[model samples]
Target: MQVNLRFFASLREALGAQRQLELPEGATVAQARQTLIDLGDPYASVLAADRAVRAALNQQVCEGGAILSHGDELAFFPPVTGG
Candidate 1:
């Protein structure tokens, strides 16, 4: 399957830009992240453990169980902190 991916804030700088990615059959959000982690230096910084980045599936904040599908839009961003 394939999914549309987006990066926001600092994550966007690290990821360079959002684009479509091919995912393994039935891959979960977490699984897809591992692939992203290998993308490059940008990905390494974006996916660093200290960041605790957030993900949304089709505009909905999703958890570990979030399933992936063709053409699904997924976004990654750092946790919101403003009051």
Candidate 2:
């Protein structure tokens, strides 16, 4: 399956604004993240398992375990903080 990936904030700086990825059937958000991490370098550093990152599926906030579908839009960004 193919999905659209979007990176925001610092993640965008580290990775990029967008890219297309091919994942196996029934891939989850976590699996997608792992796939990028496996790329090493900036991808691994920015998306390290220990880092606090947030994900959205099709513009809605979702958990890492959330299942992904073909052509879905997946976004990754750091948590927002404001007062």
Candidate 3:
């Protein structure tokens, strides 16, 4: 299955603004992340398990366990804070 991926804030700086990814059917957000991490370097560092990365599925905030679907829009960004 193919999905649209987006990166924001620092993640975008490390990775890019957007890209399309091919994932196995039934892949979850965590799995997608692991796939990117597996590519090594900046991906592994920016989306590292130790970092506080947040994700959304089709504009809805989701956790790592969120299931992904074909053509789904996935976004990753650092935690947001406002004064």
Candidate 4:
């Protein structure tokens, strides 16, 4: 299955605004993230397991366990803080 990926904030700086990713059927958000991590370099570093990243599915905040559908939009961004 293919899904849309969006990167935001510092993540955007590292991975670009968005791209298409091909994942196995029934893949979860966490699996997608791991797939990216497996690509090595910046992805492995920026989306590392220890990092505090946030995710959204189809524009709604979702957990790593969220199942992804073909053409679904998955976004990743660093945690936000406002004063």
How high is each candidate's TM-score?
0.88, 0.98, 0.96, 0.97
Task: Pick out the ten consecutive residues of candidate 1 with the lowest summed lDDT.
Answer: 42-51
**Deviating ranges (above 4 Å) for candidate 2:** none
Question: Which predicted model would earn the best TM-score?
Answer: 2
**Which segments of candidate 1 are over 4 A away from where they belong?**
none
Model 4 / residue 48 / CA error / Å: 0.2
Report the candidate with higher lDDT, 3 versus 4: 4
Highest lDDT scorer? 4
- Considering only N, C-alpha and C atoms within 3 Å, which residue pairs clash in candidate 4? none
Q: On residues 10-68, what C-alpha lDDT tens digit does candidate 4 reach at each position?
A: 99999999999999999999999999999998999999999999999999999999999
Clash count of each predicted structure:
0, 0, 0, 0
Q: Which residue runs does candidate 4 get wrong by more than 4 Å? A: none
lDDT of 1 by residue, 37-64 (tens): 7776777766865669888999999985
Deviation of model 1 at 68, angstroms = 0.4
lDDT of 2 by residue, 1-83 (tens): 99999999999988889999999999999999999999898999999999999999999999999999999999999999999
Worst 10 residues of 4 by lDDT: 73-82
Better of 2 and 4 by TM-score: 2
lDDT of each: 0.84, 0.97, 0.95, 0.97
Q: Which ten residues in a row have the lowest lDDT in candidate 3?
A: 39-48
